[model samples]
Target: MMIKPLLLAGALSIGLLSGCATDANRVPEITYEAAANSPFVATNYRAADALISQFRASPDGGPLIVATVVNIDALDQSSTLGRLISEQVSARFSQRGWAMVEMKFRSAVYMKRGEGELILTREIGEVARLNKAQAVILGSYGVSGTVVFINMKIVQPGSNIVVAAYDYVLPYNNEIRSMLVRSTR
Candidate 1:
């Protein structure tokens, strides 16, 4: 009697597990649709274009060193959002016939010096000088509720004067957030 019960239990266990392993039962079928504005790339691009136009209209505008985007609120310290903004803005500037100095080398110098954050305007000017750039393009972003406000500034390194500034407000949706921040494995 004991042997029979044990064998029956073993058979049931195997049957249940085998049933669970089948793809049809394990996962539910779902359809996915392609998004019209994937990752909101166009939004960033528009902001970049606007920034370029604003800067070019200024008297102090010309060759600019694009700096990494700085978050004055300290929320995006570990996020890649700043880098994405910098790249997009720089690309737009380039497309509009403005000379752009890449930010990576200048940023690396500060990283080597152990600067915690890149919010200092004076340091930004120094970086511009190092790259032989006439002006520096620096940006800052802040989030309030479900909205994000981004501000881009063009400043002359010599006079420490802001030549132009552009502001953009965007909804803080998941797609946009993912583009700004990197996902860790």
Candidate 2:
């Protein structure tokens, strides 16, 4: 009868739906070794240390201004990862006894709504001069095939010369992917 066919179809649909739901919940389990090797912040700290080692200028030269890291393709745009990396690198510099000028307290640098303080190559001199910064720390990042490459430079504003530079790579994991989401604000 028509009713018997309808009942069989309804049962089959429900069974298929439940099977898909179960499969959707099964995420691959990560190993303990993998979990212990998380390296986003630590990698950045190491890069900062490398830059510090190569730096010939004295820590007492003057205060250093740290700018937020931005996408290499779009210098004005930044994501959560960019801001966090800037903060971590600034902290490392401060811990190393370098006087770091806090960008949030100064309005001389260009700050976008969703992006943090960003000084273009042309505007670096003006911003550094306005803040009386000895050097400005700038960085850009690019992603390629499960890895994110970062390059940081400490530049003397007056001479527009790189005092120190460091380049590093980080694994592009889920956490990084989330942080790379462009701000809607």
What's the TM-score of every candidate structure?
A: 0.66, 0.80
How much lDDT does each candidate structure score?
0.66, 0.88
Q: List runs of model 2 lying over 4 Å from the truth.
A: 1-37, 183-185
Whole-model lDDT for model 2 versus the true structure? 0.88
**What is the lDDT, from 0 to 100, of the residue 90 in candidate 2?**
97
Q: Which residues of candidate 1, in runs, are more than 4 Å off?
A: 1-36, 56-62, 75-78, 106-108, 112-119, 179-185
Could you list the CA RMSD of all candidates, in the order they appear? 6.0, 4.1
The stretch of ten residues in a row with the least summed lDDT in candidate 2 is 176-185
Q: Write the per-residue lDDT of candidate 1 for residues 47-155, one digit (tens) a residue.
A: 7776666654532444677766666665335246666677777787777677776555544345412222354665766666666677877788886779878888878
lDDT of 2 by residue, 1-185 (tens): 89999999999999999999999998878888887786776888899999899988888888999989989877878889899999999999999999998988877777777688888889989998887888999999998889889999999898889989999987888888899875423
Leading candidate by TM-score: 2
